[model samples]
Target: MLDDETPVLDNHLHLDPDNHRGIDAVRDFARLGGTHLLVVNKPSWHLGVEAETGEDFRAVFERTIEIVDEASSELDGRAWPVLGVHPGLITRLVDDRGFSPDEARDLMQAGIDVAAEYVESGEALALKSGRPHYEVDDDVWAASNAVMRRAFERGAELDCAVQLHAEASEDMTEVTDWAEEAGLPSDRVVKHYASGRLEGPIPSVMSEKDRLETAAERGEPFLMETDYIDDPDRPGAVLGPKTVPRRVRWLLENGRDEAVRIAHVETPERVYGIDTEATLERA
Candidate 1:
């Protein structure tokens, strides 16, 4: 039997028809005391599919919503939905097959318009986006803010959260500034994959830790994710299942028990809009 205290939450998972393992994986997770899973529906550049126009993107977004609804209904509280336009795809949108920057911006705006609609519908739990190496163009940043502002407006109406994937400490700062400028609650902006952004040989001593601590101090919730699937070859890429427990142990050892608890404990509840008191009591 799995102990209720065993912490688990797949904060950033890509669930597509091509890669889905079906309900059995979810059942296994639940059987092991996995409290929640936030299924993020964002385009993957690695997969080579791009949603350039609003209508084209809405189709995929709607399909993703359907998937989450199905999974949430089937699992009975094991799964939830997160929606966003990934940053990497933003690059693809701008660097179109053979278009100018102006053309790319026009294309990206179309997708942003559709994302705004999803946020307005209360179907999305949070807004998520990630840059590969923390490098983002001003136009892309502006577009992201426009989308975020629309989401914020709708979030206020529906009482939802905005989850973001910041690739570096600087990226987090830029997003934070935009959210602040938009008057969005600091709490609404949650950071994902925080530990993986460190660049130096000694990541521990780098600014990533400081950035996480600073965010925590500022009342912004930061999420630690394994983003890993079942693959063993890609150990450091995503948070592999086999590596999660060890990572948690390391967090516990490094005086980051609270961070662990925040990532494993508070985030899922917030994202899923669940009452975690009962789960915490069980733990």
Candidate 2:
């Protein structure tokens, strides 16, 4: 949407393999002028795994890294990857597969430990984790919290950025507190699928135009995202990948170029420590 073809980056979206989008979602996003994207992988590894071992968990993680490699190669370095044990996955592992809370926690921690290695190795730029579901039993709620706590702990140990998926507009003080206790800072977190008005030091991957305008006035740092599920059942659920650039263009037309630049470029480069210049050079 830029008049000058300035590359746009999507900070969050699901580009899992075999998505209903026949071609790779990265390509789809890129086709819309999105030069770079962060694949927040939540399902491909767990669309339900039958194997039940710590080793198996590690293998699944290894496969996720492979998927990232394949996508990067296919897209010529525009696809950045993120890995984590989402709360929904934890729910299924315990509720459907009959895992004890402790068992589920152990498996998730194992996978997260492996993902942290990828983070350390620069294979993954960020970690994705949070209570993705709103309503649930007390046990599921507690387990989700425990698993997310472990995610924060790993992010802290590795000093990597973490993307949080939670109920939109919810107060994020709890999450910030969790990060603080995990030895991570609130500024290291990115609030995914956010409503944009939520108050916090944590940056949000936001979409609302009003909030974008407000953020522009307040000089808040944020990133834009579609959170496109990529599931045909929920076709274009939250939005399309083009949403980021479209919003950026609108912001620019409305005289908010500074805000657009901060959200689309500066924040992502700073938070994930990505070499955007190197990424463009790869092109």
Candidate 3:
């Protein structure tokens, strides 16, 4: 309570055992006023460019659920899992394993289906799927878009929100179009790491202070993310989740209560479905 009175919800975090950032990172985040965390289970790594078996992916997801419980118990903050098939794996499979385009797409769908199953069973809250390492190759675009569309479709079928980790150039209009085609509303698809292109139809998480000011000026409501890599070597590769609350508190200190209320409280509760009152007991 010493940090800030306003309860904060971090919509994206990584407490993966594989990353192994250690519990101190979670404690540090809580100590700094992070109340709730959406712990996105890391997908396969781009470093080891190997094809992943469906069983291997499922095991990783199951471990993700376990880590969510562990983080919530060990840290004062509430933790939830965002399950998905990271698109980079598809690229690796095609590029390293010599998987044909169809094989890669099919493998991605299998992983997505598993994630959808977890969502339906209440093992995870939302979906996190994105196409990364995109290039001018029309085949890559075709495959990536198809994978993202399928992710949206799965989310729609399960009535869960979908968060994308796609290209920075991908705008809300394009995402909304895909979501509509997949039978989901625009607001349910959150464009993570959103920058530059603001004022989109869907909700997104931003980090820049000036852009945050711009969003406030336009009366645009969105969430904030640090993309917290939890890597000691990278040392806040994206940022530490604590950064969001610091920014929000600065705004609150400066008479930006309305903006803070909308972004931190209302928007997170509405979009990420977190109960702010029940979290960050350690903070």
Top candidate (TM-score): 3
Q: Which prediction has more favorable TM-score, 1 or 3?
A: 3
Question: Which pairs clash inside model 3?
Answer: none
Error at 101, model 2, angstroms:
2.4
Which residue segments of model 3 deviate by more than 4 Å? 1-5, 46-51, 74-77, 196-201, 278-283
- Write down the TM-score for model 2: 0.87
Model 1 residue 116 lDDT score: 57
lDDT of 3 by residue, 34-116 (tens): 66677787765621324355545677688778878877775555778898888777667777679877788888877888888
Model 1 local distance difference test score: 0.52
Q: How does residue 76 of candidate 1 score in lDDT?
A: 26
Model 1, range 1-283, lDDT digits (tens) per residue? 3245645555666555445453444555455445556677746443345655656666667766776666554432355567766655656655666645555555555665566577667676666543444567776666545554555554444555666554545335555555555666555666555553332111111123454454444333445444544322343454433334444555556776676666566755554455433433232
* Clash count, candidate 3: 0
Prediction 2 global C-alpha lDDT = 0.70
Query: What TM-score does each of the candidates earn?
Result: 0.68, 0.87, 0.89
- Per-model RMSD to reference: 5.9, 2.7, 2.5
Q: Tell me how far the alpha carbon of residue 178 in candidate 3 is from the true structure, in angstroms, after superposition.
A: 1.7
Whole-model lDDT for model 3 versus the true structure?
A: 0.71
Better of 2 and 3 by lDDT: 3
Clashing pairs in 1: 226-239, 228-239
